[model samples]
Target: MADFPDAAPLATKLRNTLIQYYNIEENAWRIAKKTKDTTVWRKPSEEFCGYLYKTQGIVEDVTNRIVDHIRPGPYRLDWDSLMTSMDIVDEFEENCCVMRYTTAGQLWNIIAPREFVDFSYTTDHEEGLLSCGISLDYGEVGHNFVRGFNHPCGWFCIPLKDNPRHSLLTGFIQTDLRGMLPQSAVDTAMASTLTTFYSDLRKALKA
Candidate 1:
């Protein structure tokens, strides 16, 4: 940990990504500042936590349904249109579309068509299983996020982590898990929740 004497918010990876991707620094400045406490002695900041906190609500407010309807398209919140900074910066505006939205209990109830599954699933190996369905692609992150949610915290891999088919599930940032489950909890939750979910999925699929 380097002590920032000037205590000014030096650029961060997230900010740099925002600038490099969007071209405007100010848009991410507030978030960067909030990301940490360079103001006084502080701790590590979560990757894009402030941004997630800022935009999740915006996205949530815009989200009509948790399932089919994708947003920032011709919908309620055009993230690009709404953000004044996008004009100054590139914003890239990658589509992190909504794939699945349900609680731990409701996961197996969700369905992806068999034809869709056959088309996308690439392989099943010891390390992890890779599926390639027509998902909502977000250019930045390798996978699509559950829209209007707190990112990886809400995203999870369905395969059982300990079943030799997979090692880990989601990729959460792993900052903290106190008040609310942070993004880091995704992998753990995915591993923890997988057995039950997978079994349910099997039964449901057979049903």
Candidate 2:
């Protein structure tokens, strides 16, 4: 049962950080993995010991609809395979809320299931929509799950000017899955998980 004294400042910071990440030059990131539908890039994180991953792909949907499926909501839980469960712990004005969620183990459970409490915000950006969040050190860790921290993670969905039916979906993810896991395992799991995310989302939207 932890809470923020004020959400406005936190929301503002999250939005600004996400905008900055979106503006990062392409040369700063090195390609980590590429799939049929998505490409992932990674760079050393400024805030943590882990790497910040960037994933980009063209989604066959409008910006608003795509954002709906990504933001903290039922649609997200229904589509995101890594997210096993989610609950809204607190709600604030202007599409901001606190979410408690658990992720399934990756890399054949070598990473172990992890839980996080995050302050999530969804807002309009110059391109289209930005959905972002940062982990909070709130609540006691569940006995069965390791506590993980996310550092300034977000997604920007922008509509194509010529083809309004399609949108460019880009994401920035940096998760510190705290535990005794090896760095190599974490790196492999993250890249694989991110690429799978895009394929799953596309299938969900088509369904």
> Largest TM-score belongs to which candidate?
2
- lDDT against the true structure, per candidate, is 0.23, 0.92
Best by lDDT: 2
Model 1 lDDT, residue 32, Cα: 16
Model 2, span 134-193: residue lDDT tens: 999999998899999999999999899999889999999999999999999999999999
lDDT score, candidate 1, position 192: 36
**Alpha-carbon lDDT of model 1:** 0.23
Error of 1 at 11 (Å): 26
How many pairs of residues in model 1 come into backbone collision?
6
* TM-score, one value per model: 0.21, 0.97
